[model samples]
Target: MPEADSSTTPAIVLDGVSKAFGANVVLDEVSLTVRQRSIMVMLGPSGTGKSVLLRCLVGLLRPDKGRVMVFGEDVASLDAGVAKDRRQLFRIRRRFGMLFQDGALFDDMTVGENVAFPMRMHTSMSAAEIRASVDDKLRRVGLPKATSKFPSELSGGMRKRVAFARAIALEPDIVLCDEPSSGLDPVMAATLDELILELHKTLGMTFVVITHDTAEARTIADTIGLLSRGKLVTYGPTDEVLRSNHPALRQFFARSTEGPIQVL
Candidate 1:
């Protein structure tokens, strides 16, 4: 509900971000900045810590080293209660939304209730107001009539759309999508991508998408980061990364086997 500056103050800043689970390091001294209102795609093979980085960015996971700043506040050091209070980071987080890979909808609740879940938990809206908001969100996602169905009743794509509706219910400034196109076919994937771009242009919101689909990445990302072995191997504009001669990036774009990525 807050107005994001959409300036160059970095929507998210990870300085020397690292994480280790005992002896295995998931992210190693990775540093990156996501500019406001830009679509940043984090691409890498499986197990390269893409999801880990995303969780850290959203404060779901804390890194062992360096700092994670959201809207200029250090989230890694903020206490649990303080982090959720009326602080800059909390307000900034309210400006962002997230869509998980599985849609993550509650099986017991109807689609409308699912979309209204956040509003119910966070707001003091009356029952009628919540219903109105839920209806609006469903219509926004092109699923005005799918409100009564449960998650299992809808198709995978429909469930995803419901999840998306829930994510933007609060009109977040940014949307973090983890493998948004993972379970959809080409047609459905493209439709979802179109929805993303449409929302970005219409709402003036930033997007941080994590996906390994090159086609989708090329289609949606203004900036791309190629991550490998817990590090950002390459980062730049989509065209620049595609035109680059770096072996890792080149082989990745070409779908080659002999590159920095190990096929284990």
Candidate 2:
């Protein structure tokens, strides 16, 4: 992978971004940039706001201060009125597709219906066109023949793959994945990782993945941002961030209890 040109606008930028829920500050003065066509993995312990940050990037959560720029538009600056904000967010969200943890499929829908859901909702494509696209995407994710299966019938990994197919059905420029490897055995996790890599390379889309798995991050991240206690402990190229001496990050990646990161 080549370094992104500094002169080019980044795919996503978060500057001095902060978020809170009631009195709890989930993110404080966090800043990071995701390069175009690159994979950025955000690593952190649970409840450290990794998912919150992802939500902010996609305009699901508005920050208290600072700005979030996606594809050069400031999402945080949208109008405060509910209708206007929603309109703006809808436009911004068109550029992104999200894969939630646990797949989040509709239990009543078949795999084919789930994969075709986005296109059905977002596009006016004919039924034939949507079916063709769903088949293509399912095949891409290695689930060609499983479309008739319901969510309940598939394994955890298969459900995840179906969710992934749904996410990319619209061909969004960016894909946000929350814990893509969670709840899987090592072999299944590895399979999912390879699929992520393959899709990234073949589709050339930017990916922002929130994960607690350091090894998965190391495998998929071109850049790594480690969050702790509502703050970004480190952010840089994967190798550079991994080489840092930051206490919180050191404890995180090394899985050690002898550092500043104490589990509650």
Candidate 3:
């Protein structure tokens, strides 16, 4: 057989995925593909399954029914409790990095320490190597002089940039940002969007961002998805999906109260 082509394989594929907690369905047969080296923005209202989908991708949760494929492996089938599966899952998780909604940085550590934490934990690189890499990551996020500053010393936007630097410390193939623009003003959010675009353009990694911010989605996503009431309402090329006559899409973009999306 000819060599497998990496270009044709998507970075992520969620096929007929469903999840529930008791009677509360969080994801209902949601299916989507995230291409490599592209930014995918998932838009949804609060309580929708956007965050849960991220958890499923990282194996923090498993789907009730369906496949969650990351780089061709079905992550939904892995069980952390089993030794063999755990090993495989660990390897899979290493390919992914996440930026939490709250910019989950350690309050006690300096920015450099925070960025180097992942490398220290998972990599065999030398201390000098880690330090150099930390500086480079910080520079990439536009915080070159913040290595010595504590999280408390920085503004919310700066903190988020530090968190993003940490997320990409390992240079993972895919980075997941959960509400990256949360807790920031519109200008700061737009700055974050620019950082995302710059990083994607320079480093060439796949990005999956889950947010309710349509503006951020429009700025960063080449592919867009909308999740509501545990179902994927619309997903496709950004221009195509935005232009389509989908009620949820319209309601979301228009910021209208009357639509299929119920306010909860």
Candidate 4:
């Protein structure tokens, strides 16, 4: 079969994806499409398989059923245990840059070094080039003055900004942000949303942002998907999903506990 044009192909496709840890089901036949060069926001209450979905896309976790397609490649079919397959998986993974929930920055490394970490590990760029790129990325994140400081010397928001700078150091095709607004105050979180928007426009990378904050989703998402107990209940354009009267969707936005989504 002739392959679809790369420009038109979706960045990610999950068909009937399901994951289970023994008897507990995390993802139940969940399927969705993330169009290329778009920002997708995944919203749900705590413990709704949002984080697991990101891991599945990167091959950190495998699904028991269904296919996970990334840019026309079926990642679910590749076995990391095999030498050749592992190589292929590595190539697929190189297309991704992940921002962890806790802003996992090395405490001892200087801000510039932390941003340069991925480039040093993955690419053969010369030291001068890495240093320049690090400076540029820090400037983009509004943290140019903190280059010599350690993570311990920075505030929580500044540390996260440095981590964001590192996540884009490789210029990956897809960037996955796990709870980008998790621990910050509302102002800081909103500031990060603006940064995400700016990076998306300038970098042209597909972004899948997992966030529980409704305001964050509304502020940044081109498309929105609501996941409940591993099932995708409502998904569409950001405006459409926001207008939806579906109980689960409404309950989530209204901050209500009594609805189709039960509180444990």
Sort the predicted structures by lDDT, highest score first: 3, 4, 2, 1
Error of 4 at 53 (Å): 0.5
**Candidate 3 structure quality by residue, lDDT tens digits, 1-264:** 322227778899999999999999999999989999999999889999888999999999999999999988899999999999999999999999999888889999999999999999999999999999999988877789999999999998899989999999999899999998887788878877888888788888899998888888888899999888998999999999988969998999889999999998
lDDT of each: 0.84, 0.87, 0.91, 0.90
**TM-score, predicted candidate 4 vs. hidden true structure:** 0.95
Per-residue lDDT of model 4, residues 49-97, tens digit only: 8888998998888899999999988888889999998998999898998
Model 4 clash pairs? none
After TM-score superposition, what is the CA distance of residue 173 in candidate 2 from its true location, in Å? 0.6
CA shift of 248, model 4, Å: 0.9
Clash pairs of candidate 1?
Answer: 95-173
Error of 1 at 218 (Å): 1.1
Residue-level lDDT for 219 in candidate 4: 93
Per-residue lDDT value at 85 in model 4: 85
Best by lDDT: 3
Runs in model 1 with CA error above 4 Å? 1-6, 81-92, 126-129
| Per-residue alpha-carbon lDDT of candidate 1 for residues 1-264, written as tens digits (9 for 90 to 100) | 333343656887889999988988999998888887789998888888888888787777879998987766677765546645436556556767889877899999999989999888767989999899899878877788998999999988889889999998887877999898888889888987888888888887789999978899999999999888898888888889888867877777788998777897
Worst lDDT run of 10 residues, candidate 1, spans 1-10
